[model samples]
Target chain A: MTQQPTAAMLAIGDELLSGRTKDKNIGYLADAMTLAAIELKEVRIVADDQEAIVEAVNALRARYTYVFTSGGIGGTHDDITADSVSAAFGLPCIYNDEAIKRLAENYARRGIEFNESRRRMARMPEGAALIDNPVSTAPGFVIGNVHVMAGVPQVFQAMLANVIPTLQGGVAIISEAIDCPFGEGDIGTELAAIQKAHPHTSIGSYPRFSDKGFNTQLVVRARERALVDAAAIDIRAMIAALQG
Target chain B: MTQQPTAAMLAIGDELLSGRTKDKNIGYLADAMTLAAIELKEVRIVADDQEAIVEAVNALRARYTYVFTSGGIGGTHDDITADSVSAAFGLPCIYNDEAIKRLAENYARRGIEFNESRRRMARMPEGAALIDNPVSTAPGFVIGNVHVMAGVPQVFQAMLANVIPTLQGGVAIISEAIDCPFGEGDIGTELAAIQKAHPHTSIGSYPRFSDKGFNTQLVVRARERALVDAAAIDIRAMIAALQG
Candidate 1:
């Protein structure tokens, strides 16, 4: 069996760190990566500072198969992802003629001037490939295994669509969720034994407490469908026994 | 001026990384910390992995004044946060009699068995201080500067209330926002000048595109209210000039 490709996500913006903006990109990327059969192992949210962005990009890209960064790729003064990504790789960030042309055409269609600030979106790290943004004209870029994307949800999602097809995917992970109306304490020992018996599958027990009362959701995940099914069956039987 | 008390947040759970759960704790903590005059510097989301949890805990605790971790403190087999935190500090993780007493009493009142799995919630690192969980009976703990809390939103928020008051805070950061009906490219240069003129303040321009039209919200934040207001005035003037 081939190893699944691992990925790490970096969410960059002061808005996120300051709680001025709630991040929507991480969950979107997580779901997309799961469907693409990529294992998103770690996610980090950092501010707009260039040093922080460079440090996070270098660390994540080294540790994972692919590193995806969202935000700090706009035309504003704080949009420094391209510069930081370039610094991480020791590459010169320069304006690409193709990006410039695309931006100019996009602005012209909207009857707006492609001014210097908007023109800033044309900049890319040397040797970087541009990721298309269907929602907006400003293009994201890929330097090595790291893909830099816009912070805007629409642009980020569109850019991801352009990038996902270009990557290699492994076996898709299969998951099964069982709602068990038992507390974690009631099922902890039996759940551990079930987890031990099915070493191939990863079982997660999430306890939910509401006015309706305490309930637990046992999520079983594995690369093999048969293994997930087997583990889930045992979990169901255990829950049934506890209730009986 | 005293340095602002900085914090880092670690959101631990496979559910978050797998997109099965959307994290609410990070944003909640971020806003609470901001209001309390604490700076939230970084946030990380990692799966239920021991090594990863230990590494993140060690790194954040070393870098920031306070480290807050949410999740993985439940009674399930996958709840390994206490063990990982103990390993990070090289401290022995043992069941605390006080915590056990509290859990037993709470369970007894509810007519629930304080079984081994539920008993697991009483385990903490040696010499750790307990943080009260007002919502749930399971108490979180503080070992050194790291405050470990539950993954459940209600429990996490309640634990945060207990933890926030215990920390020393610095000067409260004041922020002002101005909504500009202009694209980022149109306001980029002027915004950069405004940011440079107010060196003590951090200016962030967030662009929004919708059916209403392209707009930008310029957020100016600083430890001093005067400086933030000053920056916001300049930004508002720039927007008015552009519109005129």
Candidate 2:
């Protein structure tokens, strides 16, 4: 891991790709990752296919410090994330006894059937640890660097909250946002020079077009506050000169 | 290439990964792709780095029938999607004469300077065709099967609308949503049986929990209406039987 622990998110589902469910998890996870001092490097939204899930999980887990996946952990036929993740790690998917006990007790209390279908929630890769889901009885599993969580937003959030406390985070990135009166075109060259000067700092320009014409938001980010502030100062100066 | 045209989205920007800017393009494009009779298979959000962009562009372009990219095509330091995409295709990113002409004319009408920075908007891969941008007049370009569009929602929409008409679309996928009174656990086994029975149709179960407890939405999707309808009927029957 670098100064900031890098992470890749795999948001798996068919509904997201089909436009049936607009993903609400990626942004939420991204925000949470930012707060935890994790550098979210990539996000891949793949289908519910086991092959797709396994392939993505293998690729992401190897590349990043942490790989977080949300979706397909339910008690349905399409919920193959656990099995796929197990396959990715070359482990057999098995019914975790602790997970099964919890699910069984919860279902019993709720007067629900603890049948094979519901029991699917207890499935995990062999030797994987569990991330407790307060909202749902089904526990998410952590195998190696990858953490597999629920597709439901509420459950995913709850599991994430549980996972955060256990993490030994890296340096938190500090940032500053400067609103530029001019468009990106007016300051692109100067912005490029500023970026070259601060190689370690990330400077991003966001342009918005409306009735007021184009105005850009310059965001400077770095592991240290002084680095971000310095870049922000340079960006503000560049914008001020361009406004002249 | 299949019955339904397949597409993969490459959302390029560092802001999205950093959680500084929530992505608005993926959902919009997913909806648009659905409407255009195209099946969106995968979505990858990568940073503004040239290497990441190039790698993702190459991977998605080869796998899907069409690869659509949004963001990082702006005239800013972080905006390197055009150059990266050109590199992916082994082509030189050149400033197109027609694009330059349009930008120059638009800027002249608005009494704005057509400076070197603004001229960066005219950059595209050699031998690429242009996609008209009705919003800001910065043209998107198409090289091979990849369509590069703006990051801005309005501009991306306009370019997509323009691109849709030009495409030879595949079979339109039809779908039906059946509201299940029971949770996924209650009907998972029967639903799986139904899904197994219908090989052509895709059956997905989505569960929601509130004060009312768990309720699932079963969506059936296929190339033809009959295939989707058949699976939906089976799902409805399973839900009704479970309810009784």
Candidate 2 achieves a global lDDT of 0.86
Best model number under DockQ: 1
Candidate 1, residues B50-144: lDDT per residue as tens digits? Answer: 99999999999999999999999988889999999999999999998889998998888768878899999999899998998645668999999
Worst ten-residue run, lDDT, model 1 chain A?
A: A207-216
Q: Write the per-residue lDDT of candidate 2 for residues A1-244, one digit (tens) a residue.
A: 3566789999999999988888888997887777668889999999998898889999899999999999999988999999999999999999999999999988887677799999998999999999987556689989999999988886787677667656656755566768787876688899999999998786766554334555666767677889888888888788777767
Recovered native contacts, candidate 1: 0.81
Q: Which tens-of-lDDT digit does each residue in A108-133 have in candidate 1?
A: 99999989999999998989988988
Q: Chain A TM-scores, one per candidate?
A: 0.97, 0.69
Q: Which pairs of residues have clashing backbones in candidate 2?
A: none
lDDT of 1 at B77: 89
Model 1 lDDT at residue B56:
96
